[model samples]
Structure formats: C-alpha cells, structure tokens
Target chain A: MENEFSIEVRDLTKMFGGFTAVDHISFEVRHGEIFGFLGANGAGKTTAIRMLCGLSLPTSGKAEVAGYDVFRKPEMVKRNIGYMSQKFSLYQDLTVSENIYFYGGIYGLKRKVIFQKTEELLEKLDLKHARNTLIRDIPLGWKQKLAFSVAILHDPQIVFLDEPTGGVDPITRRQFWDLIYEAAKAGVTIFVTTHYMDEAEYCNRISIMVDGRIEALGPPAELKTRFQSQDMDEVFVKLARG
Target chain B: MRTIYFILFKEFRQIFRNKAMLPIIFVMPVIQLIILAYAADFEVKNLKLFWIDKDQSQLSRQLLSKFEGSPYFRLTQADMSREAAETAMERDEVDVVLEVPAGFERDFLAEKKTQIQLTANAIDGVKGGFASAYGQAVIRDFYGDFLEENAARLSWQPPSGGTINIASANWYNPEMDYKTYMVPGVLALLVTMIGAFLSSMNIVREKELGTIEQLNVTPLKKTHFIAGKLIPFWAIAIFELAFGLVIAKILYDIPMLGNLFLLFGLSAVYLLVVLGLGLFISTVTETQQQAMFISWFILVIFIFLSGLFTAIENMPPWAQQLTYINPIRYFIEILRSLLLKGSGWAELQQQFYILLGYAVLINGLAIWRYRKRS
Candidate 1:
C-alpha cells in the first residue's frame, strides 16, 4: 500500500548513556502538510528531527521517512529528504550560485537542470543581482532564504528545517514563511521546528512537545480551543509549564 | 563518481579563493626549502685544539706546527699543563688535546716508533670523532716525513711483501655536497606538510562551520566524500612536488638523475599515504585546532624518523623497523636514490611496492572510519 503520511514515528527513543534525550514519542506528518514541531529549549524537538532526517539513529523505535525505514534504510531516506539546519550551513567563502551548484550536484541532479533551477530560484527570490555574491557578504536574511532554497533545490519529497528562521526581522521572517508556503503548495512536505509562536500559527497542524512527550497535537484553532487560549503563544506556554 | 567530482570542484574553488591559503600552498614551501638548504649541513669545521708537550723535542714542535697549518684545528695556548687543558675542555674552549710524553724524541729516534696520546671531547660525538681522526692523520703524515729525514741516520729495510693501499670514490656527489642530499629530503618534507596539514584541516573546518551537518543529511556516499577530499589535496600536493623539483633544479642545480615518470609515479602513491593519514586524523578530531595539534604531533615524529638529518642505520633496531612504516622515510629514500644514484624501477621496486601497500591500507582505513550516518 502507498504510504499516506510522509513521516511516521512509533515509540521513538534516543538515549545518551544513562540519560534519555528523547523519550518514547509517537507522531505522524501528512503529505504536503506544514507540520509545526513546537517545544521549549531542550524539549527534544531537534533530537526528534535528527532521527527522522536520518542524521542520528534512534536507540529503539521505528521511523519511516518517505516510505523508507530510517533505521534499516537511512540512505534511501536521505536521498528522499532535504535539510536546513538552524545555523547558516552554506559555505560562506563560496558564492550563492556555487553553493546551489554544489548541493544540486551532490544530489546527483543534471547540470542543465541545476542551471535552470538556479535561474528560476534567483528570479523568484529577487536575488538575481546577488547571484555571484559570496554568502558571507550578504545579509543574514538573504543567507537564510538562500539556505532554504538550496535545501529544496534537489526537490526532495520531504524537507526538514530545524529552526530555520531563528533570528531575523519580522518582515524577513514573514517573507521566509511565504517561501515555505509556496514550497508546500508544490506538494513538498515541510517539517519545521521554531521558537516563534506566530510562525507556529502558519502550520496547518502543530504538535507541542513537553520534555520529549507530545502533550498536544491537532489543528492550531482546535489546539487553541482545547487549551482555552487566545493563540499558539498561550497554548505553548501552558503546555510547557505543565 | 560525479559526486566526487562536484565536491572536488567545490573544494578547489574554496581553496583558490582564500587569500592566505594560496600563499601558504604555493610560496611558503619553496621559501622554506631555499633557506633550510643552506642551514642544514653535516660538515664540521674550525675545531679548537689544546697541546701540552712534556717532550721539548724538535719532533713535538713540528707536530704542533702541523696542527696550526691545517685549516680544521685552532691551537689554544692559555696554559700547557694537562690540568689547564682539561679545564679548557670543560669550559668548552677547546675540543681536542694532544699530550706528548717526555721520552718521545729519545724513543722515536732509538725505537723507530713512539706514541702520542690524543684526547678529544666526545660530547658531540660525530664532530669529536672527525676532529680526532683529522689529528691522527696529521701525525701519521708527520711520521712519514720523519722517516724520510732520518733515512740517512739509520738504514731501514722494507718488508718483503708490498703493503696494500685503499682508494675510495664518491659516485654521484663526488665533492660530497650536502645540499644535494638535503634538497630532495626537503622536497619530500614539502609534500608531506601540504598533504598532512591541509587535508587534516579540511573536514574539521566544515564541522566547526556547521557545514558538515548539512552534508550529513545529504545522500553523498561515504566513499564519494572521502574520494572528493582526497583527490583535490592529492592533485595539489603532486603539483607542489613538481614545482619544488623545478625550483630545486634551477636554484640548487640538483639533477633529476633517474626517470622523472617513475619518481612522479612513486610520489603519487606516497601522497595517498599522507593525505589518507590526514583524512583519518580529521575523522577523529572535533575541531580544526585539535586536528592541527594531532597531525603536528604525528608529523614531527615522521620527520625526525625519516632519516633526513640522522642516519636510519644509526637508530636502534626497533626504531629502524618502525621507519619501515613511515611513508616520508620511504619517499625520501626513493627520492635520494632517484636524484643522486639514478636508480631505476629495478632498484626502486622495494620502495614502490611498500608505498603501494601504504596507499591501499591508509585510504581504506580512512574511508572505513568516515561514516555517513554518524
């Protein structure tokens, strides 16, 4: 049977020696959905994303990403997903075009395809003038947008973004979200982790994690009414405090 | 294969763009080689000598004059007593002492043979031994002159059988130029430094910059990543070798006596051993500083044990055995043979095969140690 969910986890646990970093957590993300994974600092959001992205192996549990077992077939999962870390991970010494070319080349895309994608991506972001500019020479906002573009340049089935917009102006953050919405509309599953409560409202569905456990999961409006809160900010604070 | 090519292309672009990195890669080694060539020499000169002659005979005077005439020794006349001469040696004022006993002239004329005691400070043993040997040769030549002068005083008969005389010749470096011996060793060092230092820092820099995280999530194969890292540094180090050789030819007048292709071929394998070692170090280290420290520690040992300055034969049996695994030592041996002795593939087969083994084993281990999932 074809898998309906893009990512599925059943009792995923990761331990470092005696301490458990991620407790037995279970969740599923639907295809083409904007899934907001919300938690306070050290609430196992990053750990969960790492396991699902196939960068870290779970100590015990089952995780299927893009219909491939994360534990048994991580390479297949890797080929089918894209990742943008919280830190600006592109080569600062390299130009924007070079960074895109490198990422696309590593994903085994054809040169002509990469060229076409580069042109389109630059035009869409209105960064045509900054095409040959070094990554370090650009503003933080532009680097973040370019990072997201490079991550999805391979057109993976799912894209994992770990706190991609950590620190940016409100307008830039909103613009960054617009890019995410556009990618989502193209049927790319976006699994984003973030601290900004307002940005969490943009997700179609949200799961609030408290100390490695999913305390709340549903649509944002449903979660707000269930928690008797006005917005995602109050729901997050109430869930974290509990 | 294409993944490796792309990574390599990216690496080269980044390497070429860094303003500091280009000078370090291209210019620094050549400058170090030229300066170090003039400084690293084994030839000892200007040894100080002290003489205390108890025998005031003409023969003793002649011997003292001989020491003064030779350019290697400088005679000190602070005090003629044995105690004073020993004190001078203790103070590092003199390196050798000649003590002639009282009956030297009487016994030499009567008994045809007399002994002169020569004492040398054997602290720097190599220099001390050479100095003492020079003193002995001067005395022997003086003895021959004495025999000629005393030929009329007493007729001496020769032995029936003729004595044998030994003659020696230096094959390639007939004048024993230390520069010729050192240029190839220094060239080997240049390659080792570039291969070890640059590559060991490559991955760790990515880790420090958080770029490795982005790479880990991608579908790049472990073998492909390793090959990508290896190929760029390997090609650069090979270019470095060729460049240094041309500089050696122009500046030092050192000849490429053997087949250039064979030398280049062996150097390619040796570069793998060095670059693999660097990549292996990178996998274990968490930061660029730690990688630099660890590679520096290992490289110091490799340089000292490579027989660049000291002879491998002079080391202990176990240390000599350890040199067998040192890639730099093998390269130095191959280079010296090729540049000085004009050694061909027939003669260099042993070194070539060992390097091949090293290339395979080290690169295999490096690729094995590098994991995509972790």
Candidate 2:
C-alpha cells in the first residue's frame, strides 16, 4: 500500500545558503488520501510543497510526484498534478470564464471539453451568473475557490493547495473544504499545507513540521490521543511545545 | 499552436481594452510622422542677406540684382560701407554679407579684373557652407551673363569647332522631398519601436503579476509559452507596418515602387527579429520599468545610427562598422531601396539574409535564456 503512494519522498532536503528550509526527511502521501501538511510561519511548508509540486529543485534528495522523478521528469510531474498557490494566482483582468479557458487550454484540454467543464464547475460553485465577470471584481473567497476549480480542471492525479483558505470567512472556508472533499472522494489525492489547525483535522492524515523537520505524522485522531489532547489543535500545540 | 492562439487572443483583447495603450500603440506614431515630416525639411527656406555696393555701377547693380531675384536669398539690407554689413553679421541678423570692392565699373572695363567679398555666419557649418556656395554660384552666373553680352567685343569664341553640352536627370523622387526619403525609414523605426517597447515588458509583466508561476505549473511547454506571448505582438507589429505604409502613401504621397508582398514579407521577418529582441529583454530584465528603460536606450541609439536622421556614409569608419550589427540600419536601407529605388529580391538579398540571421540569432538567444525554472 505504501508503494501505491501517489507522492514518494526520500531524504528530501532544501537549503538556502546557511539556512535549511526542508531538512533531510522522508514521507509518502497515499493514493486517494487527503494529507495535511501543517507548519508555523517559516517552518518550510511552502518550500516543501514547492519541491513536491516540482516548482523547485531540492538541494539533495529523491522525490517522485505522480510516479515521475521530480528531478528528471518535472514536465511529467507537472502534467499529472494541479497546484493552487496561497496568492490565488489568476489573471485579475480576465473574466472567470476566460481564466478557466486559459488554464484549461494550456493544460491541453480540448476547447469543447474546457467549455463543458467550465460550465459544470461554474454551476456547481453557484458562480454561473458571474462567469463573465472579471476575477478581481469577485470577492476573495470566490476567487480562491474558482482558482482551485480551474487548477483541477484537467482532473490530475494529485492537487496541491498551499494555504487555499487563508483570510476567508468560516462559511466560505467550509465551502472551500467541501470542494476539496469532493475532489478527494473522487480519488484525486489531496496534499494541502495550511496553518489553520481545524483544517488540519479535516485531513485523513496530518504531519506537523517544525524547524525544517516533521515533528509528528499520523492519523489526526490517533495523533490527538497520543498527545493526550481533546482536539488536533491542542495536540499540535502540545507537540510544538515539546 | 492552439495555446499560442489563446494567449495571443487574450493579449489582443487586453491591449484593445486598455484605452491609454490603444492610442500610444496606434495613434502616436502617425502623429509623430506628420509632425516630424513637416519639421524635418532640409531645404533652407528663409535666408537673410546684406550687401555692400561700393561700385554702385551697372555691373555691381546687376550682381546685387542676382541675389535679390534668387528665391534662396532674401536681401535684408544694403550698405555702401562694408563696416555696417560686418556689424550686421556680428549681430547674427544677417546670414551672408556681400561686399562689392571699391573699384566701380572701371576695373571690369579697363582690365577685366574685379573681386567680390562675401561673408557668412559659420555657426551652423552646413547651412553656412550652402549659403556661401550659393552666393559664389550666383556671382559666377552673373559674370557669365556679363561676359556673354560682351563676347563679340572681346572676340570670345570656343576654341573647338563644336561645343559640348551635358544634361542630367534625377530619377524617382525627382523633387527630392526629404519627407519621401524619411517616411519609409520612419515607418521601419515605428515598427521596431512598437516591438521593442511593447513586447519587452510582456513576460516581465506576467512575472510581476505572479502569473508566470501559474503558467509554469501548467502543462504548457516553454516553447508554447514563448510562442503564445510572441505571436500577438508580431501581429501588432505587422499591422503597424501596414498602417504606417498607408499613411506614407496617403499623407506623404510616398510611392511604393517595390512589390507590396515583398514589403510585407520583409516586415514580417523584421518584426520577428524585433519581437525576439523584446522577448530577450523580458527574459533578462526583472521589472517592467527596467525593460522599458533598456528598450528606450537601445531604440534611441539604433534610431540615431540607422541613417534615417543622418547619412551612414558620412559617419566615421568605426561608427560605420557598427551599422553592420545594427538591425535598424539594414531595415531602413532595405525599406528605402524597395520603396524609392524599386529594388528587387536580387538587389536586397544581402539585407534580407542579414535580417533573417538576426531574427534567428536573437530568437535563439532569447529562447536559450528562457528557462522554466528561475
């Protein structure tokens, strides 16, 4: 089952000059599992995600994303994965529909397929009326959710979300999580990094990274029991304190 | 190819939507062409002159009449004292001063010897030289008429049994309108200006907007990404070239003697070079402001050295050597030859190859410099 992991990492390490952002660590993200990567500010969560998403080369390590070597087959990895950054990167000047088309087009989806997927996704998100509206005019939460939908428009094997729910109202955040859950249930592996402790509880498995190393990794409930805490937040605080 | 088309469509839509950019891209060049065309005439229209007539005889009066009758010179004042004319020259009011020496008509009648003094302002050396040469030619013509009138008295006849006569003809652009010569070159510069300035910031702008990272994560190949960004600007540049040619034809009445197909073909190739150059700038520079500044610096130098404003032949030998690498120099030469000289492919093959080579070299360099990673 471990060999069936969608993402495999061995001794993954990234260093910037004298600073080590991601220490020599190993982890595996299971196929069809929602894995939460939790870290405080500057705990190297984004850097680690960047490596896993094949955006940056690791200083020293071997990692395979979507069965492609992150070093040699980055293009293959890119083709098989979707990524949404913390910035909710979408062209503000472009309409939401235009952004969908652009992203879908670049991903090699047929025009008809893109159109169909765009209509379906907009309808599902209840954003069909605002399809022609520029992304900047929409509220930030809607843009974040739309960005995530566009990222996975091609139905990649794994979707990487970097703090996808940051600075959003709780209701919008729950809606965003519903979208993530829907993708995960459809057998798309979800690897997300967030500082929100409650969001971490929603993941099937959670890893707490501190000082460039994973301090703990297990099922969220088991980790809470092992830490003798009522919830994942107290568990994370207890582990962090230790 | 589809990705490139999508990117190009988006870029075109954005450019059209931006009201400020629309005028800058479309209207400014036409306005500059008209204004510069009128302001840049080389034909010295109004020339100021003062004359000193010490002789006050028929010959002297006749010489002064030549100056006054000529459209090139305007007689501002006349004085018997050369000193007053000299003062006028010092004050910069008079461009040229002609002094008839105090020999009256006695010298010409008795000894057939006379000398005229001419003074010119030398501040603008070229204008001063033309004025002095014009004055000398007028004096020579006046003397020739006087000599012809007294030919029998002096027994003046050609020593040869027959006289030789020569006639010269100026070909296309007979009137030598400076605007005609400049319009084609200006059109070329305008295409280059649009390409270098507009396209250079394209990728840098994406990077600034953080869209580049989004693009990088997509399945789009680097070549596809570059082509997508390049194609729209290439089309815009070609359209600008066409628009410029239309203005050249309608407003300046510049004739297109060469094949329009050939002009478009060359313009397409030249625009590729410019687009490549712009992309190369975008890849190297980190900011849009830097891209613009660098493009401006390159364009100013290229335009100055392109022989549109100045003759490359008159430049120093070392400076002329630099023109070989200057793409605008070759483009201007090609445009002028095609439009004014009606040069065929055989005549323009050398420049064609140069532009083609530059297009490949710069584009290859730009692509090589561009990396998916930082």
Candidate 3:
C-alpha cells in the first residue's frame, strides 16, 4: 500500500545460524518524520537498520524503503538514502573539501553540482576557512557536524544517523541537533538511533525495542505517561527490565 | 563509468599520500633488480687456479699449459710451491691448487705410470664442483695426448684417440651470464610481490579503518569498486615489469629475443591471477595482519615452485605435479622462454591458457566472497 510513509517493514527477521536477531518485527515511518529507533545494546536495532538501508539481507519478510524492496532492489534503496554511523564516516586522510567532493562524486553527482553543494555546505557549517584541513586534523565535534552535513548533501529521501553524537560535548551536540532540525525542516525523513533520552524527546515519534521486539511505539510524552514515568530513561528502564 | 573514475581518483590519492608506501612501490624494484641479479647468481666462472710443478719437465709444463689454455680457469702462478699454493687457497686468492710430483718423462716412456693431485675449495658446493670438474677435464685431455706419444715405446699397439669425441655448445644464453638468467626471474618476483601483497592489504585496510562499510552504503557498484582497486596496482605492476626489463637490458645485456608485446600481454593476464588471489585473501581476512600472513603464505609457495632458482624438471614427481597449480610457475616459464628462447604464441599457448583460466576462477571467487554486509 502506497501512502504518506516513506518506509514500511513487515515481519522483518534476520537469523545467524539458529539465533534470530530481529524476530518478526514490523514498523512504518511516515515521510519527513523524525524517527528515533530506541533500544538497549543487542536489541537488534543495528540488524533492523542494516536491512532497511539495503546493506544486508533479511532472512524472511519484507521491507520497502524509498519505494524500493530491501531484498530485491537494495541498490535502489542505497541510492535514495543517506547513511551516517557514529564510528567515523568521513575519510581521515582526505581534506574536508576533498571528502565532500569524493562522497558527492561517488553518489553520482555532477562536478558542477558537487562544487555548488560543497560551497553551500561550507558556508552553512562556517567551515570556509578549514576547507583544505584534513579530517584527521579537525576536532571531533566539527567532524561530527561535517559528517551530518555530508550525509544529507545529496538531498536523499531519508537519512539514517546511527548514534551520530556519541561522545560530543553537550553544547556541540545541541548545535548538532540544530543541523538535524534544519534538515528535517527541508522535508528529509530523519531516522536516528541514539542512547540519549533528551534526544528521544526531539523525535516526532520513537520506538523502544526489547529482545528483538518492539515493546512500545509512540511520542515521548505519550510513552512517559503510559509507562507512568517522567522521562524516556525511566520508560526505557521499565520496558527493558521486564 | 563515472563511479569507477571516482573510486580510482580516491584510491590514487590514498596510495600517493601514504608516506611509507611510496618509496617501496617506485624505488624498491630498481634496487632489487641491481642487487638480486648479482647476489642471486649461481653460474660459476673464472676459477682462480694455482699450480706447483716439481718435475719441471716438458710433461708437467704441458699439463699446466692445458689449464692456462682453458677459459674457465685463471692461472695465478706456475712456480709456486705446494705450501705457497695452500696459502693462496687459504687467503681466498685462489679456488684450487694443482700439484704435479717430480715424475720425469722417463716414467711415462718406460713404465707408463704417473700421479697428479688436484685440490679445490668447496665452501660453495657448486663452485667447487665446477672447479674440480674443469681441472679433471684439463688433466684428462693432457693424458690422452701423453698416452699417444708414449704408445710407440711400449710393445702394444694403441689407437690415436682413446674415447669418442662428443661435440656440444651452449644454446640460448651462450655466455652463461647468471645475471642474464636471474634478472627476468627477479622481475617476475617483484611484480608478484607487489600485486599480491598490496592488493591483499588494500581491502583489509578499508575494513580496519571502517571505510568499506561507508563505501558499501553508497550507490557504488561492487564491480566498480573492485576494478578501481585492481586497476591502480595492475598499472603499477606492469610498469614495474617494464622498468625492470629496461634495467636488465642496460645492466646485464639480457636478451629480449621474443616479442615485447607478448611478454606484456601475458603479464597482464598473469597479474589478474595474482591480484585475484590477493583480493580473495583480503575477502577472507578481517584485519591487515591476517591478510598479510595469508598473502605471505601463498606467495612463498608460488615463488619456490616457480623455477626461479632451481629447475622444475629436477623436482620429484609429486612436487613436479604440484607445480602445475602454481600460477608463478607458468609465468616464470613464459618469462624465461620468451626472454631467452624467444618463444612465440605457438610455443607459449598452453601457459597462457592456464593463466587465463586461473584469472577467471580466482577473480570470480574473490567477487563472490566479498560481502557488503557484516
């Protein structure tokens, strides 16, 4: 069924040998929705996201991302989605400008368009002076901001941020969210996974996964009220404990 | 096409930017070519020979003269005593000593009996063998003439020549320059080392640095990525082969008897096999260390069996059979044959076809094993 949602997963499961990582999990993400996929370590969040990004195959069931099947048309899924993992997505040896052009070139952007987009990104991120600085020499916070900007550079239909701000200072992370808000305002669907509860409140909707199953799915305030807790941390603790 | 170009651009940038790897790629072959061609030499020539003649007779003079006439032995002294000859051998100034006892011509004329002694240093077994054999050949020839001269004095009839004369000459490399033979083999080794070691480590480095994961998420095709990785090394290895060949010709006067195009054509196909093997190794290994170990294991086996130093025909039956599977064996055979014997397509078709089949199989396996997902 084609609807306002950009992603629809049905009974998606992944098995390594006999152990099931993601067992019969299903979900839908609306267009331009800021989806915060929340789970404890080893809750199959990575497994599920890998399937949606078309980087991996699902053992059974179906997933459609950007109107493309995750199983049959993974390349199509990859082409339409921008992905950033918390574990350093940019090339360390390449200059800031070089990384931008290289990533843009691989995305099949024309030279002129990559140049134009690079200029806009540099100006927006206030990185005009550090264009030739190697990513290795750049500070961690600036690197994160640059990574986020590059991820959405292609104007992909959806952006997957896998723990994009893990060790950044509070102020830098606050500014990082500002960039996310700017991208969301431009109608790009944001699919972010993070451990921070305050980051959960910023999402339009969130799903808490427990033991390969979705225990709760709703707005943070609704989940807080339903769980009889004041914050997402407590809601997470209540669902994860049982 | 555009994707392939971008990947190539990125790969080239990284390769050139690497400070530790740049000198290894460009400078190493030149050094190895000059040093190993001379260092790895096995052919023995110019044996230093010192002789002591106590008889001072015409017969003893004839024997010493025979050694001087030969091209393989360089005569250092004729009047030196046995003790002096021993000192020369000890000082490493001579490889052999020939001592002729005080046997006048009367012994051969009256009784046809005499004795001579030849001693050789065997520090290098092959060199010693050549020296002893050459010394014996010179003595045997002198004996043949001596027997003919003394035959009339004896009561028995004897023929002019005692043994059948076997005529032979060296072919292909007539001069027997060891460097001429070894330089091509060294070239083969250099190319193999570069293609196998570098290609094996390329993907593993990506895996270690977490770039492979980033690249996998893009719209880039797997074939484009592999090709981009393969092409740069392929070009570098082929360039190394050409560079080595030029050095071999200039330094060693190595014969380039065959078609240069065929050598390069076959090298390109052979590279696919080794590069594919490298890529296969990389796909199976997680870290650069694992890939390096595996690559080294495979390279060692291929090099030993390639007939660079020893002949494959000399190997035992089972070992000879094992050499059939080695890609290096075929390439080195093609290299030596084309470089020395000037072999053509008809002479080298079997080796070429084997490498072609090997290339397809190995590259196919490498591509199949490479997973986009963890």
TM-score of 2: 0.92
Candidate 3, residues B178-227, lDDT tens digits: the string is: 77788889999999999999998988999998878888999988888899
Flag the better candidate by DockQ, 1 or 3. Answer: 1
Q: Least lDDT summed over 10 consecutive residues: which range in candidate 3 chain B?
A: B103-112
Write model 1 residue lDDT over B1-374, tens digit each, in one string. Answer: 89998998899999899898889877877796888787888876678888889998898899889888988888875355889998888998899988898888898878656789889889999999998888888887786667666767866743333334355787789877889999999999999999999999998899899898889899898888888988888999999999999899889899788999999999998998999999999999989999999999999999989999888999999999989878899999999999999999999999989988988998888888876665
- Could you give candidate 2's per-residue lDDT for residues A199-226 as a string of tens digits? 9889999899988999999999889888
lDDT of 2 at B267: 82
The native-contact fractions of the candidates, in order shown, are: 0.84, 0.50, 0.63
lDDT for each residue of candidate 2 in B119-222, tens digit (9 for 90 to 100)? 88888887898898888878877866776777677645634424333345768789868888888888888889888888888789987887888888876788
- Tell me the tens digit of each residue's lDDT in model 3 across A210-237: 9988989998999999999989999999
Output the number of the lDDT-best candidate.
1
TM-score of each candidate structure, all chains considered together: 0.94, 0.92, 0.89
User: Can you tell me which runs of candidate 1 are displaced by over 4 Å?
Assistant: B51-61, B69-71, B75-81, B99-115, B157-164
Error of 1 at B347 (Å): 1.9
TM-score of 1: 0.94
**Candidate 3: segments with Cα more than 4 A from true spot:** B45-106, B109-111, B117-129, B141-167
Tell me the spans in candidate 2 whose CA falls farther than 4 Å from its real position. A1-3, A17-19, A220-242, B54-58, B77-93, B104-106, B109-112, B150-168
